[model samples]
Target: MGNFDIKDFKGVIPAVLTVFDKNENIDEVGMRQLISYLIEKGVDGLYLTGSTGEGFIMDSEERKRVVEIVIDEASGRVPIVVHVGAIGTKISIDLAKHAEAVGADGISSVPPFYWKFNENQIVKYYEDIANSCNLPMIVYNVPLAGLLGMNVIKRLASIDNVKGIKYTGMSHYEITQIKDEIGKDFLVYSGCDEMAMSGLLAGADGIIGSFYNIMPELFINIYNAISEKDIEKAQRLQRQAVEIILYSLKVPSFYAGMKAVLRWRGINAGYCRRPFENLTEEEEKEFKEGYKRIKETYKITGVEFLDEL
Candidate 1:
């Protein structure tokens, strides 16, 4: 991996979803199609194999294949940030090295979960991963990783090559504090789709969310609106995004709902892997109806792909 400027990692990065076949295998064709769709829509970056991508349920080989496919499909159009997080440190380190080897722009990992870990252990985990590879590391801050506070974040940020964080929580105050305590160049990406605007206003450098997989243009619009200092337009788009988020939550599975939306868009983003159910026929019908209502209400256009669906 070569030197990467933190500025290149900024903007509306999507925590991309993993496409799977009916047999629960990686759908490479569908995955590439989805990648093309997003790139054509103009996403700033791609976060592969994260929670939205169902990385945890996949094994090491599957994860590596995803990294390879995404990087190849992206074709240097946009930077790919592979999420190399795992329950085990060795696997996480291995994935981190693989990401760098495969030419990922950066690497990110959530603190080891499923077993209670102290702050020192969490700090050490990040330090180990950051040291494992040459690419810059982004600390993923989710509540499941034990609720990292500003103090813990500050400690982790001190590690060399630890560039920034993917903040998924609701605390806008922490976003400001991270930029305040850490440097302004510290890349803070809002992991929550509902708060894309608020996160930007709170000093977040960008956003990475599951919802971006379905409607990336909207989020891109919001980011551009904020950049142009069009607070009114940003707020309007944010409200529409939150409405879609609320409807998405009503589905049986959030990830499944997102995939369903992609399929509706003719992208062929297949179902979630085993242990996670896809939306039922009834749920799909309801979701499509709700989505139609949202599209009409928001006057969202330029998604010519949806017209065929």
Candidate 2:
């Protein structure tokens, strides 16, 4: 905690999609390309090895390797927060220590799930990992791992290095409550994609979402619009994003649909690994057509240049 300010974690960070090859191995070159692309498009930071990065599916070594590759390529251009949440407490600690060793700016983790862990057990789990490294902790309330209650959230936030949270649920009132009841300096990032405008208005310091990997500019526009007090403009852009997200949800998997969109955007973001469906030939075609409908249907803005599909 020497000079680390949790405020650096704010703004439009992508839950960054992990790039993989046809065989679903980590593709280092593709990963570097995607990092540069997002940074060039004005992303504030990168959250690696979370759901979008497919960390839960990868083994410990694989997760550590992904963090290493991203840190080396990013070269400190933006703050990198690695997700260290895993099924085992010791494994999460190991990953957290590795992230600290490789110079990641911060560490985050979803709560351990798949079984019952009492409140104290949960608190100790986070406490152990937070004490493992000097890097600040961003508690990820990403329900894929498990849900974190408000009482547990406050307890965790009270930890020495625990500074913020990635609130993936869709409740702004809760965001407000976290700030008002917890420290006002506490950083809470809205993890839900569709609620960008509302979340910001509700006092979310920043936004981190899976969809940001593909349409970062649109979300950035929403952030700027909020800053400029242009509610009308922000609402319009948020609607466009919601449109895209809803359409992506219709695909075999929203994450896979995002990869397809990334390829369409000229980035070679590969498919999600096994157990997650990659788009079929027919699905890909339908995804493209639905994308075209979005473009025609809305006065969309802030997306970088793209060729017609």
Candidate 3:
């Protein structure tokens, strides 16, 4: 893929989950299969090394390996936007350089968290990474990442190397305001799964959802339909997608449900790392029942999500 423009990232792009083996190591085979599955399902790109991918918890070596594995598997078929956000500036720069070296299509970084920083410091932190890498940078602004506001985002987006932003916060109005003030070329993506369509309506370029790892086709279809101005079809698919996620929410284990769903399809994206629990046998059973019920109820057919089965 040659130089992926921010506009080209205007469909569903999942922040894919990182698979770890029992030894707490990257499951290379599982990751490859996961990337293949997503591509086959018609995802526009992969948001590698995000919160869902356990990026913050991973060391620089692990982050580099994940990026390399994803780029190798992508094979220029789909764009891979690597997330190089780390708590430390040096490590984040190291990851960005690695992403550039590995032929990543783009790079994104979350604001430094756990320690409060003034606006100038945040700007410098991002500018440092954006300058270090050749890839266009996407500013990831997740509310859970210590509450940086849109004013800071506008300033950061104005940086020459900053191409776009992944706005994962709950503030739709702020996202709209950012889009309005920043002008075009500043692509903004929704970070939340449930608000995927809502964000699109509010001027988001696309979505970067963890839920897309489990349901790429449906989300991508809904996104495409919405973009084409087919609200009827988009709304129909969005309802079905949300219905399934509701089960994950009700089960009190969304990530666990994701792993179980992946395992059921034999992709082996593996269980999440420690402190993030996997599904029990009973939970898996319930999730399977929920999945089947959703498919049967919606009468879905010939979709990429179903092709995995």
Candidate 4:
């Protein structure tokens, strides 16, 4: 079994968005550049093929290819948590095994989607996948999954090799109860960017968010401040980060807005995949102005300058 465990999974891990060309093909070069850029920005880890990464829209081969590309680019510098959740049991297991084969640090998965899975069914599903790989598993309790409930989280957390839950639905207090009931060894991560500080205050070890892909330095500062017991600084940064998040929600697609920001910075990550809308010209213009506002209002350039060093 791999020595990889949950202890190594803490900190700001972005649910990275997959970069696509105009034809909706994966831009491998752009992806590699983005990975390097994020690593340079001091992000602790990457969560591949999650909702932000548009995992469900991709086929199995595409998902595996994305994971492989991310792993190859990352080169063990940051822990890579591959999200292998799928509708079928065999597919999920196969993705989990593929993640292990490709040298991912860990695996995270949403419960069976589309159907309302019972607690035992969900537990058995995760148990089977975890047993198939040496990588520690994180249960992603996504609100959109339609199957995850309080009972599901508690049951899944009890499974062997299931070391964490990415808490996205409901309130932090609900997650806190699960942590209290299950014991602290079960790592909890805030799945939403806007709720990161609140989740951390409620005992979340860290966050797995989409916006962190665009503004990692801000999140990292917030995390570091909290870790240093500087609650005041953490709160201030959190407020600033949330302001950017709120504006992003008004754009066409949140991931597209983030990709546009990267392109503005010369990253050239391309656009969001199809069916998922891209930013219109108007939104693009607003995004630039909004981004400028975030930087100036939150003093993000100063934060990023230090991050460069």
Give the candidate number with the greatest TM-score. Answer: 2
C-alpha root-mean-square deviation, each candidate: 1.8, 1.7, 2.3, 2.6
TM-score of 3: 0.92
Off by over 4 Å in 1: 2-4, 296-309
How well is each residue in 169-215 modelled by candidate 4, as lDDT tens digits?
A: 65788768877998888888888788788888889987889988878
TM-score of each: 0.95, 0.96, 0.92, 0.92
What is candidate 3's lDDT per residue for 1-309, written digit by digit as tens?
235665677678999889888677999999999999999988988899888898877889999999888888888877789999877889889898888888888889888988888899999999999998678899988877775677888789778989898988877887789878988668888888887887888889889999899878778887888889998888777777777777678665576668777887778888777777777888777677766676777776644444444
Badly placed stretches (over 4 Å) of model 3 are 1-3, 292-309
In order, the Cα lDDT scores of the candidates are: 0.88, 0.87, 0.82, 0.83
Runs in model 4 lying further than 4 Å from the true structure: 1-4, 293-309
**Which 10 residues in a row give candidate 3 its minimum summed lDDT?**
300-309
TM-score of 2: 0.96
Residue 130 miss distance in model 4 (angstroms): 1.8
Better candidate by TM-score, 2 or 3? 2
The most accurate candidate by lDDT is 1
